[model samples]
Target: MPTTRLSKVFPEELSEDTIHIIVQRPPRDLEFMPKNKRIRITEGWKPYKASNGKSVDLPPSWIGFLESAELEPDPRKAFDYLKNDLQAGDAINIPSMGQVPKDFGIHDQNHKVFVTEQMLELWEDMRGDKD
Candidate 1:
């Protein structure tokens, strides 16, 4: 009998089943835990003025909340609250919030949680359902 060569078939992309498994896994709670110190403005820091002539201060207790509250890992949600709820103006608070330190930069002044591209990629990798 003559022998015939078998053609090889390759997948164009990863299988949807594999992708679903990777994305459907529950997100780690530690991944979403806030890992930064919160700061609240005191009375002495109240009525602080921004370069734009807008007041940019928080109540002492609220400052305490900012400086102490557990932050959400999702930068979008965090920023949304910061912009809408905190209203720290575009100066001190905004800048500080937007530029959280490397150890605490999970959120941004834009109130974006996990705003970095890498973070988004991680989110997709862990939650993508496209299969």
Candidate 2:
């Protein structure tokens, strides 16, 4: 069976000033945890600039949360508040994230999180009775 993969298609070349990336907290189900997680890229939603001169897609108030990265003495802890106290169904933002390589075919330079059969079963367990 072919493996599933994911990647981002950036609209333009990203620079440090233009975007803030956050590793998202994984969705939870019972006691099981997801092996992989995702990152949320905030580009101010692009083209629409808020008064603070940054773009906004999340809460307009969250712009401050994104910028709070600067307050963290330990760079890794940037956006710490969003991720620090999370419960099931709670999505939080993290400062740094990493990527894995592709599973098959040609080597995709882009990171690929190999979705295993076990992962699928976990999803089914989590989705139980939900619409």
Top TM-score hit:
2
For residues 1-131, write the lDDT of model 2, one tens digit per residue: 22222224345655655455545565665335433321223223333356688764664345565556544343556544542333444333333353222352255423233444575556567657767
Q: What TM-scores do the predictions have?
A: 0.17, 0.19
Candidate with the greatest lDDT versus the true structure: 2
- Model 2 sits at a Cα RMSD from the real structure of 26.2
User: Residue 21 deviation, candidate 1, in Å?
Assistant: 45
TM-score of 2: 0.19
Please provide, for model 1 over 8-111, each residue's C-alpha lDDT reduced to its tens digit, 9 standing for 90 to 100: 23335445444222223556555554543222211345554545778776566655654554652445554443323222222323223333456553444443
Pairs clashing within candidate 2:
44-55
Go through the candidates in order and give the clash count of each.
18, 1
- Location of the lowest summed lDDT over 10 successive residues in candidate 2: 37-46
